[model samples]
Target: MEATLSVIGGRWKGVVLFHLLKGKKRFGELRRHLPNCTQRMLTLQLRELEEDGLVKRTVFPEIPPRVEYELTPFGRSVEPILVGMRDWGEKYKARL
Candidate 1:
């Protein structure tokens, strides 16, 4: 469990959570932001977040189809942590 938390603690998970803070987003939208990430990896991360009860995915019926992901209250609780990480990252970069 500790290892799993660490796995989803940073990297694309934080990025994904940051975007979700704005509201819901589709898979493609997430892809646009994290251009270097592969579809398979993104899918896996999203599934993990969902399993951890941090994200909620909704699907809609349409011609092209629609799927959206948003944060749950549990996930929203991590906003301050994300902000602190962003601040720390900027400070670390400035020092380097």
Candidate 2:
């Protein structure tokens, strides 16, 4: 659990993964979705996830250039864990 938290606990990290679960997104698209996060922070988080083998980053050469991010197979493995936490949080909130 400690290790898991270390990888996912940074501010906005979990939120980044949560939104990526929906589908692949460009850097600008992710920025728009995560409006509260600064560009530098988002870039760092994505690099960490990539290093962890949980996220894939693809670059395309073009006039404007393009980059996309998506979850890897290992990253998809984390979905159930996130869902479980969500369920537990909802139940706990009800008790409050």
Best lDDT goes to which candidate?
2
Model 2 earns a TM-score of 0.88
Q: Kindly list the per-residue Cα lDDT of model 1 for residues 3-91, writing each as its tens digit.
A: 64574575799889888999999999999999999999899999989998889999999989999999999989878877877899999
- The regions of model 1 sitting more than 4 angstroms off are 1-4
Evaluate model 1: give its lDDT.
Answer: 0.89
Tens-place lDDT per residue, model 2, 1-96, is 999998788888788888888999999999999999999999999999999998999999986989999999998888987778778889999999
Model 2: lDDT to the true structure: 0.91
TM-score of each: 0.89, 0.88
What is the Cα-based TM-score of model 1?
A: 0.89
